[model samples]
Target: MSDMPPKLAEIVDEFASAPREVVLEMLLEFSDEMPVLPAELRGHEGMEQVPECQTQFFLRAEVQTDQTVTTWFDCPPEAPTTRAFAGILAEGLAGATASEILAVPDDLYNRMGLATAISPLRLRGGTAILGRLKRQVQEQTGTPT
Candidate 1:
């Protein structure tokens, strides 16, 4: 959780302290919190696909003129684990500055204690999600990496 945005660090703290069952439960809870793709971004037109996920995953970010970010994700309900990863991103990164999002460490999931719960392959998907998200923010706002 080092150098994470405040909200994201708080989320990682919760996961880090939770028991295994509680962590998984929190994942589902976050999954439910994930917002639907706004009508404008639906149909996967501008979204980037996360093929690393076993399930279909797509995400995109909008960087406002103020350099704040708004993230979006699309993952079917059936794929709760994958959806939970997107949920974490949607919750953790929303409203962060472009640089804040870009600076998020790639090992965030392991820091959050998710590596012990989810498979390595799934962790790879989560990593990809975060990577693409930061890239999207950087591309939009020209935030220096």
Candidate 2:
């Protein structure tokens, strides 16, 4: 797997190093940490949905003047697992450069050992989330898809 941004790498390491049972607990903690959308984005006007997710998950990425990327997620609280995945991405990739975000491998969740804890379909949701995030980064950075 490709080396991820430092913050993200730390999260992946945390998951990879934990016991299988602990991974679910850690994921739930992340769910609680998922940041709320800013007031301006509350209505989900421009955000794109990850249809692969079992829950209604929407996200948007903004590339700042400094070229750092900020990602926002809108996930229902009841969907803790999906919300946790979004939390991981939001916290891990916040303030990372667009190029850095784009460099993240598509199978990062697998590297984090999530496949053992979640269903294959849930893993697909995580992958879809990463796909949309990367796509937004590419669009913002003028990188060809």
Candidate 3:
């Protein structure tokens, strides 16, 4: 896997080291930790939907002047697994620099051992989330693709 920001790397390591059953549990915990979007950002113009996911998942990312990134996610409570993926990205990548977000490997979830616990389709959704996050980072940072 590529070098990830310290916080995101820590989360990936946590999942990697966890037992199969615990991985799912930890994912759900992340779902619970998912923050609601601030009222002003809710339904904002820049938010984009990830069509690859079975459930509706929308996200918006902002790269600050200092290059730190802030990501916002909207997923229904009923889609705990999808919400968990968003939670992981939001919590892990929040405040991470654009370069750090860009460096994260596309297949980091596989390294986390999540494949053993979640469906292949769900894992694909996770990959889509990361893809969208990276695109937003590049857009905000004005980095050429």
Candidate 4:
């Protein structure tokens, strides 16, 4: 995580050190803390859908003129795991630059020790979320992957 954004690295460290039971509980907490989508994006029609997730999940990421990233995510409250994944990215990667977001390792969820707490499919979905987010940042910023 040496190349990861500072805030994102911090979150990863926190999860990496947590016990399995605590990881699940902390994941739920992240779900609860996820920000609501802005009114303009509430429709979800323009957002990218994360089909890997069991529940409906949509996200949009914008790399701003100032180089800070702003992301939006939409997922049902009942889908705690998926929502947690979205929340973690939304909060952790907030204000990161394209390079910082892209530098995040592909196996980040696993490195966070999430593999033990969540099902493999759920972990895959979380990985997909980060992958898609990074792709968007790359596409928008014209940064080479």
Q: Pick the candidate with the highest lDDT.
A: 2
In candidate 2, what are the lDDT values of residues 72-99, reduced to their tens digit?
Answer: 9999999999999999998899778888
Segments of candidate 3 deviating more than 4 angstroms: none
lDDT of 4 at 53: 87
lDDT leaderboard ranking: 2, 4, 3, 1
TM-score of predicted model 2? Answer: 0.96
Point out where model 2 deviates above 4 Å. 1-3
For model 3, residues 1-145, the per-residue Cα lDDT tens digits are 4558888899999999999989989999999999998898687557899999999899888888898888899999999999999998888887788999999999989988999999999999989989998998898788998
Each model's C-alpha lDDT? 0.87, 0.92, 0.89, 0.90
Estimate the lDDT of model 3: 0.89
Clashes of 2: 0
Model 1 lDDT per residue over 1-145, tens place: 4557898889989999999999999999988988988898789998899888899999988898898888889999998988998888888877888878877888989999998898999899899988888888887776676
Q: State how far residue 53 of model 1 sits from its true place (Å).
A: 1.0
Candidate 4 residue pairs in clash (backbone atoms < 3 Å): none
Worst 10 residues of 2 by lDDT: 1-10
Which is superior by lDDT, 1 or 3? Answer: 3
lDDT of 2 at 99: 82
Q: Please tell me which model should have the higher lDDT, number 2 or number 3.
A: 2
The window of 10 residues in a row where model 1 has the poorest summed lDDT is 136-145
lDDT of 1 at 99: 78
Question: How many clashes show up per model?
Answer: 0, 0, 0, 0
For candidate 1, give the lDDT of residue 53: 87
